[model samples]
Target: MSYRAPWWLPGGNAQTIWAAKCSRRHAGAAPRWRRDRWSTPDGDFIDVDHAVYESRADAPLLVLFHGLEGSSESQYAIAFADFASRNGLAFAVPHFRGCSGELNWAPRAYHSGDHQEIDWLLSRFASLNPARPLIAVGISLGGNALLRWAAEWGEAAARRARAVAAVCSPLDLAAGGHAIGRGFNRQVYTRMFLSTMVPKAMRKWQQFPGLFDRDAMLRARDLYEFDNLFTAPLHGFKNTEDYWARASAKPLLADIRVPALALNALNDPFVPASSLPRQTEVGHHVTLWQPAQGGHVGFPVSHGPLGLPGHVLAMPEAVGAWLLQHC
Candidate 1:
C-alpha cells in the first residue's frame, strides 16, 4: 500500500507532531496488555508488553522494538498492537533498558546499535514458541538496532525471525545524528529527547558514581553532546563520532540475509532523505520504501469530519501486511 499525506496535514513537521500527540487518541479499542519482565544475562531486566490473541495461538508473532525512550504505550506501538489484534496476530513490544518506567540495574544502557540485545531477545522469543513464525518490526532507534542485528548475524538472523521491518529508522547514524542536532529539529525534537534522557542519565550516574562527567552531561544541549557524554561512553564507544560511525546500519545493508523492509519518509525531520538507502545499496532480500510523504511514523489518510481527528493507521497496516507476506 502507498501513502499520501492528508490534505490538512501538510509537510513533515505537521504530520510528525500530529501523529505523536493525537494518533493514540484515535487508535480506537485499546488492546489488553500483559507485562512480562525478563532478566538479561548482564543482570539487567527489560519489560515486554504482550497482546496475544488466544484464539490464534499458532499465528505469527509480531515483535515490535520501540524507539529511543519510547515504551509499549508509544503511539506507533499502540497502533501496531491494534493492527496485530485485529489481524489475529500475537504482538509484543520490548522496552529498551531503563525505558520501562523503572531504572535498570546495569550501568550501561541501550544504544542505537545494540544488536546483541536484539539477538538475545529474538532468540528467546523464537524459542518460547518454536512453531510460530516470527516477524520483527523496529521503529526509529529500535529499527536501526534491528537492522544492525540482521546485518551482523547475516544468514543466522533468519533462524530467529522469518522477516523484519524497520520504520523511520536512522540507517545512516552520522547523517541522522547531525540532522537532528541542528535547526528547528534541535530546538524541538532534540530538546524533547534530552528532557527525559538527561534525567535518566543522572539517575544512572547516581547508581554508578563517577560513571561519567555529571556536569558535562548536564551541559548537553543537543543529542550529539548528550550522546558523547552519556550514550557513547556508557555503551562502550570511544565518543559520539565513533558511535555514529560504527552503529549505522546503512553501511552494512548489503549484509542482511533475511527478508527485510526499510521504510522511511523522505521528509522525516529526524532521518534525512539523503541518508536513506537505494535499491542497489542493499541485498536482494532487502526492500526499501521511501515514500514521499509520511513524516517519521506519520501517515494520515484523511482529515476526519464531524469533530473527529485524522488517523495514522495506513503505515502500520501496510508494514504489517508486508511482514506477514514474508512469513
Candidate 2:
C-alpha cells in the first residue's frame, strides 16, 4: 500500500475526528445498497448490506466490516461502497450481530475476537463471487477480528481473500480499551461508545433474563466498567481483562499468511500508539501502514479541481486502488 503525508489535514486530532465531526464534507453521497441475511448455526443471523455494481456482475468482490457501533451507512463504508461501484467491483458489508438495527436471536453477541462469524461470512461469499478475486477491509473493531481470523487460519486465509486491509484496528485491545477508559478519552470516545452500548445491552438483557447485571451495567461510567459487567459475562469471559486479552489480535499478527495491511494513527484517541506492533513483530506477509496522522479511522482528504472545502477523498479510494494493483 502507498503512503501519503497528511499536509492538508493539519493535526492528528483533525484526522481522528474528521469523519464524525465534519459530516458536511461528505454531503450528497448516496450509494446504491441492498440487504441480504444469513442464518448462523447458533440460531443467530448476520445481515449483509451489498453495495452493488450491476454493470460488473462478474467483477471482483470487496467485503467490508464496520467499526464498533457503526452500520453500513457509516461514512467510510459509504465511501468504499461508492468507490467499489465506480471501479467495477462488488461491495458488501457484514454487520456484526445486533449492529444491523435488529437484535440477534441468540444471547451470545459478537466480540472483537469472534472469528467464527467472520469465517462463516467469507465462506458464504465464496459462492457469490467464485470466479473473481476477493478482498476484505475492516475498520476499528471489525479490523481486530479480521486480523485474528487470518492469523488463526494461517495459510488457509488465502481462500477468503488474497489481501486484507485493516484500518484503525485496536491490535492490542487490552491496552487500547484501558487507554480509552482514562482521562480525555474517558470523557469523549469511551462515553460515545458506552452511550450506544449500555442501552443496547439493556435491551438485550431484557430479552435474556438472568444473563447479566442490570444494576452494574446501568452504573457503568466507562467502557471498562461496562465490559467488566456486561460484555464479559454474556460472552462467557471471566472478566474485562480476560475478554480483552483473548480478543486482541496483536499476538496473532505473526501467524497471518495472507498479504495483510494494518493502519494505525500515531495520535489515535481510541488506540494508543505504544500498543502498535513493531515492523519486525508481524508476519513477513503483513504490512503495517502507520501514517503519522489518521486518527482512528480518520483519513481526511483535500483534493478537488474547483477548490472544494468539505469534500475530502475517501479512504476506500486509496485502499481499493491498492487491492486492484495487488490482486
Candidate 3:
C-alpha cells in the first residue's frame, strides 16, 4: 500500500509538524508495555519496552529502534506497537542510551551511526528468542544505525533477522546534516533537537568531568556544530565531517544481504530526495520506496475539520505489513 497525504495537509512541513504534534491523539488504543532493563556489555544499561500477546508465542518479533531523542512513547513507536498488537505480533522498542527518561552511566551517548550498539542489541534480542523470527525497523537516526549494522554484517545479518526496514532515515548523513542546518529547518527542527541534546550533553559532562569543551558545546547553534562539539568527539570521530562520512549508510547500501527496505519521502525536510539511492544503486535484496509526499516520518492518512491532522498510520502499517511479508 502506498501513501497519500490528506488534502488539508498540503505541504511537507505541514504534514511533518501536524503528525509530530497532533497525530498521537488519533492513534486509537495503545499496547500494554512491559519494560525491561538490560545491562549492556559496556556496563551501561538500556531499557526495552515489550508488547507481546502471550497467546501468539510463535509469532515473529518486531523490533523497532526509535529516532533521535525519541523513546517508546514516541508517536510512531506507539503506532507501530498498535499495529503489532492488532496483527498479533510480538513487538519491542529498545531505547538508545540516555533516551529512556533516564541518563545513562556511560560517558558516551547514542549517535546516528552507532552500528556497533545496534549489532549488540539486536544480536542479544535474537539470542533471547531463538525459535521466533525477528524483523527489525528503525526510524530516522535509529534507521541509519540499523542500516549500517545490516551493511556491515552483509549475509551474516540474515542469521539474526529475517528482514529489516528503515523509515525516513538519513541514509546520507552529510546531505541530511546540510539540509537540516538551513533555513526554516535550522530554525525549528535543529533547535528542537538541541534543546534536549545540549542539556543531555551537559549532564553527560557532569558525569565525566571535562569530557569535552563545555563552552564550545554551549555555543553550538546547529546540528553540525553540536555534532562537531559533542557527538563526534564522544564517539571517537575526528569531527562532524568524519562522523557523517563514515556513519552514512548510503555508501554501503549494496552490501546489505537481508531483505531490506529503505523508505523515504521525496519531500522529507531532513533527507533530500537527491541523496536517495536509485534501484540500480542498491543490491537486488534491497528495495527503495520514495513516495512523493510523506514528509519525514509523517504520512497523514486523514485529517479532521479546520485543518487538524488525523491518523498517521498508513506509513507505519504499510511498513509493518512489508516486514511481516518478508518474515
User: Which number leads on TM-score?
Assistant: 1
Q: lDDT: which is higher, 2 or 3?
A: 3
Residue 188 accuracy (lDDT) in model 3: 96
Tell me the RMSD of model 1 versus the true structure.
1.4
What stretches of model 2 exceed 4 Å from their correct place? 1-10, 23-29, 303-308, 312-314
**Residues 153-198, model 1: lDDT tens digits:** 9989987788999999999999999999899999999999999999
What lDDT would candidate 1 get against the real structure?
Answer: 0.90
Candidate 2: deviation at residue 191, Å? 1.4
In the order shown, what is each candidate's alpha-carbon RMSD?
A: 1.4, 2.2, 1.5
Residue-by-residue lDDT tens digits, candidate 3, 242-286: 999999999998999999999999999999999999999998989
Error of 1 at 78 (Å): 0.5
Instruction: Name the lDDT value of residue 272 in candidate 1.
Output: 89
Clashes of each: 0, 1, 0
Candidate 2 residue pairs in backbone clash: 25-310
TM-score of each: 0.97, 0.93, 0.97
